[model samples]
Target: MRALTYHGAKDLRIDTVPDPVIEQPDDIVLRVTATAICGSDLHIYRGKIPMVDDGDVLGHEFMGVVEEVGAGVRDIRKGDRVVVPFTISCGECFFCRLQQYACCETTNDGRGAILNRKAITPPAALFGYSGLYGGVPGGQAELVRVPKANVGPLVVPGSLGDEQVLFLSDILPTGYQAALNAEVGEGSTVAIFGAGPVGMMAAACCRMLGAERILMVDQYRYRLDFAVQAYGVEEINFEECDDPAELIIERTGYRGVDASIEAVGFEAKGSVTETVLTAAKLEGSSGKALRQCIAATRRGGMVSVAGVYAGFIHAFMFGDAFDKGLTFRMGQTHVQRYMVELLQFIEDGRLVPDAIISHRMKLADAPRGYEIFEEKQEDCRKVVLTP
Candidate 1:
């Protein structure tokens, strides 16, 4: 089988690899139908996260058809269409019960390896990543071995397509979680940083949650354009505005946004932007966006961060959050928790997540897809690779 492998920073390739098989009674082997690239995958491409390295298959957002199942996997069978959660949880763990599957003890952080097992050392172990998570092979291939499939839901709804349900694995649920964390409510005003795929999806969820006004911010014109044209959202070009927060406040008549969702993650800005401390903060535009989110948030409002972050940050001021009594909720989206609700939305025709998909290609062209998404070329929102 040909799989997309990560070979350090800004390097990737399509390589022939052994096909994945069901290794345990609870496991299942999936013939991947469609897989999408995620923003977290960019961390490995930039070599910022823990264990990214060459030869690691690096995709987590995927939907597929079951080719085989382990003996204990009764709910799912060969030929079932499914979407595997990015976080592979054992279902019986404490975190799984709490709907925090990302933190499950048996969860594999993109690496298919079960927790507590030993494998050859790699950069990170995320599905296609190399740092902290085990560098297990990912679904951006012809076939993938899913460690726990029974717990992972398969969408059998008659109305949904693979494109719409594919996002249920990661971004759709993630965006829903972001809106939930933001506490979007009836007539509430919300501001979301980064109009990327996740950010846009969050806006859609926010609208569904009854937010009266949704402020979508991004430096890129095309993305913000998509936000407004697709969802009837208000766009804010950070580049054009002298202060996004001030503009948002003006738009809301001096009451800042009721909630803010920071979807740019580590690209969030630092508390202070001095030359010496700039490098000490997060790597990308997220750091800058975080600063804007804090400034834009209304007093006592919530800030939900769903973007990826690594390690610590410099010049971070907890003082602002404390003074304003801001509620901060940020972490990996517990995708398993919201899968059902998101799928139902798809079934009801209220949400169409596939609108964010900008590019599609065969698994062999996975590297090119990564390049296009990384460079943000040609209004690329999400890239899907078919095996």
Candidate 2:
């Protein structure tokens, strides 16, 4: 079987690996039809994510046909096409019962003790993320073993192509959750940092939830322009502005936006001090985007983060957030909790996630795909690979 594997920083290769088999009663072996390189995958590609070893299969956004199913697996059967959620969860856990699938306690195998020691009980095990999140073999392959199969794989209608339904695995639901957490609604004003795929999806969802004004901030002119053309969002190129938060505040009549979202995560570009600190391991992540979010949000408003942050950050501006009475919401997406409803949104044509895909390549060409995406070459927004 051919699958994408991580060799080291900026090194990804399509390797022929052993095929997967059902390893648990509830497991299913899927023949991957389509898979995508997520922005999060870039974390691993850059060696920023700990515990990703050489040859670890890498990818989470994937959908495929059930080639085989374990005896205990029900609801999904052979030949059924399904989109597997990136967050693997046991539906019987306490958090799962609360519909917080990302917090499922039984799937992580307790290997996240490093993170657990930091008072953060690691959440769900994710496909191909890292040892910190359960070093499960991921789906960027010809075949993948999907655990918690009955709970995670959502069966989609044959009428929908893999491209249309693939993002149910991660970014779509993530953006939706970000919007929900930000309390976006009719006539709401929102500012989103980062014009990447997740940011664009957040803008689409905010618009759907009836936000009247959406401001998208990014350093990339192409990405910002795409957001404006696709979602009718107001674009602010931070590279051109002295201070994006100040610009946002001025645009909103000095009240700031009703809510702000940070979609760029730990690797966000920041000041020279922050960059040096992050590179030297003095800070866990750059707090630049979050700072902008806090500064651009109105008093008593919400600051929602869909971005991934791993460890402690230097000078996080907690005092500012406190003084403004801001509400903060962030975490991994409980993908199972929202997949069905978001699928309906896709079916109804209310969300067009695939519209953001700027490149498509064969699975064999994934190394090139990763290069272009990581480097932002050829105006890349999203890349979908077919196996």
Candidate 3:
């Protein structure tokens, strides 16, 4: 089997590895069809995600066909097409019943803290991520071993395309979760900080939720243009104006938007020209757009931080949130909670997630796909790797 292994910062490769097998009665093996390169994966690529290690397979967003099922798995048979949720979960846990599958007790321990801890054994593990998590190996390979197959649902809807259903693994559900977090309503005004695939999807979901006006913020002109021409979203390039918040408020006639989405993850900061990456200061948050979001949002509005934030976050003003009575929602999106409905949305032709995928390549060319996405090449939104 060929799998992309993580070595170090900016180091990854597709190498032949032993094929995975169903280890437990509840486990199942999947033959990878299509997988996605996520913004969260970038954290590991940049060496910012400390848990990753040499020889660890790298990928989470994926959809595939079931190859083999363990004895305990009865709901899904071999050859069933399914979307793999990024978070491996056992659906019978207390948190899962509460619609919090990300914190499933049997698979993910102690509210996501267990995965981030440096010292956990095989009984508690995470796929693809290194030591910080469970290090169970990822899906960016020829085959993936699912720990809790029967409970995972392995959805098979006849109407949805594989490309469309694939995003349900992470970003689509995440975008839907972002809108839900922001409490986007009919005729509401919404602003999103990043214009990447997830951001664009958030914009699309906002539109579906009946937002009258949608404002997308990004430094890149191509992304801004895409938002406008493709989705009828309003674009705001932060570099063009001195005060983005003031401009957004002005555009909304001083009422400000009803909600804002933060889609940029660790890369959420000033432009490369402004970010001084010294040894002492590896990463620092100017948080200009987020601050602008707070300022641009209507009083009592909702601010959803869907962007990935690891380790420590700096320069966020707690006072501003307190003074404005802003409702702040932030976390790794609970994709399992929304996958069913989002799959229906895709089936209904209401969401076009596949349109955002601009690059497609084989597993052998996966590294090149990473480079293109990292460079943010013109109009590059989502990159897909086929195994």
Please provide, for model 3 over 283-314, each residue's C-alpha lDDT reduced to its tens digit, 9 standing for 90 to 100: 44346567777888888999998887644345
The worst-scoring run of ten residues by lDDT in candidate 2 lies at: 110-119
Tens digits of per-residue lDDT for model 1, 243-323: 888899899889789999988877553345532453654323335666677878888999998887554455455787788
Q: Which 10-residue window of candidate 3 scores lowest in summed lDDT?
A: 108-117
Off by over 4 Å in 1: 108-126, 268-286
Best by lDDT: 2
The TM-score measured for candidate 1 stands at 0.91
- For each candidate, what is the lDDT? 0.79, 0.92, 0.80
**Candidate 3 — which residues are off by over 4 angstroms?**
109-126, 271-286
Clash statistics: count for each candidate:
25, 0, 4
TM-score to native of every candidate shown:
0.91, 0.98, 0.92
* Residue 4's lDDT in candidate 1: 84
Q: In angstroms, give how far residue 105 of model 1 lies from its true place.
A: 1.5
Q: Of 2 and 3, which scores higher on lDDT?
A: 2
